[model samples]
Target: MHRTYSLRSTRAPTASQIQNPPPPPSSTKSGRFFGRGGLGHALRRNTAGAFAPDLAKKLSQLVKMEKNVMRSLEMVAKERMDVAQQLSIWGEGCDEDVSDVTDKLGVLIYEIGELEDQYVDRYDQYRITMKSIRNIEASVQPSRDRKQKITDQIAHLKYKEPNSPKIVVLEQELVRAEAESLVAEAQLSNITREKIKAAYSYQFDALREHCEKVAIIAGYGKHLLELIDDTPVTPGETRAAYDGYEASKAIIQDCEDALTNWVSQNAAVSAKLSVRSRQLSQRRRNNIKRRSEQGVGHDLSSQDAPLNDEVSWESTGQQQDEYDDAEEEEDDETEPSKHSMLLNGDGSNGEKRGRSQEAVAA
Candidate 1:
């Protein structure tokens, strides 16, 4: 379609043009619309007229389908994430289970170690027990053999002492020897049986190893068990024992040295005390000499009475010969000598002796 408009159409709009004067009706070519011969009606049918509402409906359906597809894709992606997370959780669970198993295995190893120690200790005791049993058996065997020999000897003695009444005593000795032999044989049998039984007793290490094997078969770790079992323990135990022995020896040596030092110190103290006593005595003698000198000085300073009180100082007689007659005058009045014999003085002769006593006291 082509549409041609002429200026002559302004004369009069013809009814024929409205009814049947078009080339092709758009409504007839496609679908129905209101009968139209006007430009406004044709333009309305062309664009916003015919296709507008249907296009809006089709666009709305497309939008809905698109939203559904996006939602489905999103759901699929979410499901994938959930699956991945579940797998991670399962992996973690598996790891936890493995860790738990390993921990149990470790605990089992420690138990086995303890059992091993007990086993070794028990083995040592068993060896001693066996030795004791052997010793007992050996003793019993000898006693039995000796008793048998004695029995044979008494029987022969009876035969040799024919016609002697001592034969009855010899026969009695033979019966006693046979009884002792039987008793010795019984004792030996008992010791041997006990030793055999003790040899078969279960050791702690053997039991522990058995339990470990059982656990290993029950889904525990086998390699770890073997590794733990094969660990080097003997060297460690030997080292510990040696260290203990060395420490004990060192302690004993220290004690001995301490005792020796204590004794030496005591002897030294005694000797020092003796020397100090001698020095004190010497100092005492020196002190006495110094005191005597001080007393002498004091006495000289004071010039007290004479120190010799046992002797008396008499008055001088001045009467000369009578031949000089005038110069010699005799006193008729005479007082008797009042100073008689003197008593013994104290250690010192004067008041200085009292000072000496005070010094000694101080």
Candidate 2:
């Protein structure tokens, strides 16, 4: 019952803690009918899309589903900690070596639970970011509805009273509605892209950190296991006196230090894309850059001069072809240098070359 490695503290409650008391910890038991989530989760998920505006319905359900995921993670973290405590309790009646190893293992498992809890907090950040997107989607729905309603009214009047004076007024209103809808739609598009990128980036970084830390804990757990004497013994042959206390404590300390010092900069795992994936990613980035540049130029040119429709179309096509050709040439020039760097294993040369190429491009 000596819980030396437990994460709980015995200090008095802080002012903030006293003012805003934390909720009681949830039981490990699942609910009677609806499983761990109980009735609320099911109700929220089933009703999420029904009450949402048409434009935001799918996204609304997605947000609700993410909430369910977070709840499940919370349950899992709690259960993991419970399992760790159970492991330590179960090991108490065993022989010394087994008892010591299991207790240390419980410590590592409990740390994983703590890490999972922290991950849940960080994941809430991603969920909150996604909520921004859902809010924007909901706001944009009204403008879309207004535009459609106006258009329908205009069509009905044109059919019933072809020459009515109200038709002109409706047309003007329709134009205004269309403008507002356009602005709203643009805002939605921009915010959706921005928030989606940010939200997923946060989630992925958190996932990577959590996974790496768990792996580190597993590695040290293996070292602790090596201290156990798993060798078979003859009948009634008592094992040697338990003497791995210092070594086990050192391993635990080392693990704690490693966890404390762990940072994203020193992350040991990396994702390497295949050649085709890299090429596709590069092409996608290049296309987005070129299109953005072209859009700015097109906007400026339109403001400066009014060109004939046919002439503008032809010039735009020609400009697009020129951009494609230039991009191809740049890719060709960079590919050889990239390959050489990979072969030589000299990242500094690649960095210098990249800087020079960027300077030339500028």
lDDT of all the models against the reference?
0.33, 0.65
Q: Each model's number of backbone clashes?
A: 0, 0
TM-scores, all models, native as reference:
0.26, 0.73
Query: Which residues of candidate 2, in runs, are more than 4 Å off?
Result: 1-36, 295-362
Pairs that collide in candidate 2 are: none
Considering only N, C-alpha and C atoms within 3 Å, which residue pairs clash in candidate 1?
A: none
What is candidate 1's local distance difference test score?
A: 0.33
lDDT of candidate 2 over 1-362, digit per residue (tens): 23344323222443323443422322211122333376647865776656556776787778767767876887787677667767877887789898878887877887797678667777877877886787667656666776788799889988999998998998987777776666666667667778899999878987887899899999999999999999999999999999987787778777876776677777899999999999999999999899998884222211221222355335644644453343223113322322123225352211221111111111
Indicate the TM-score of model 1: 0.26
Error of 1 at 346 (Å): 86
Q: State the lDDT of candidate 1 residue by residue for 1-362, as single tens digits.
A: 10111111112322322332322211111221322124423332233212112213332233223323322333343333334233323333333333223332333333233223223333443334443443343333333444567567666766787577766775765566566556555555555566647644523333343344334323323432232222356643632211122222233233223322322112221223578898999899899799988884222212222221122111101111121121111112233311110112321111111011111111
| Candidate number achieving the greatest lDDT relative to the actual structure | 2
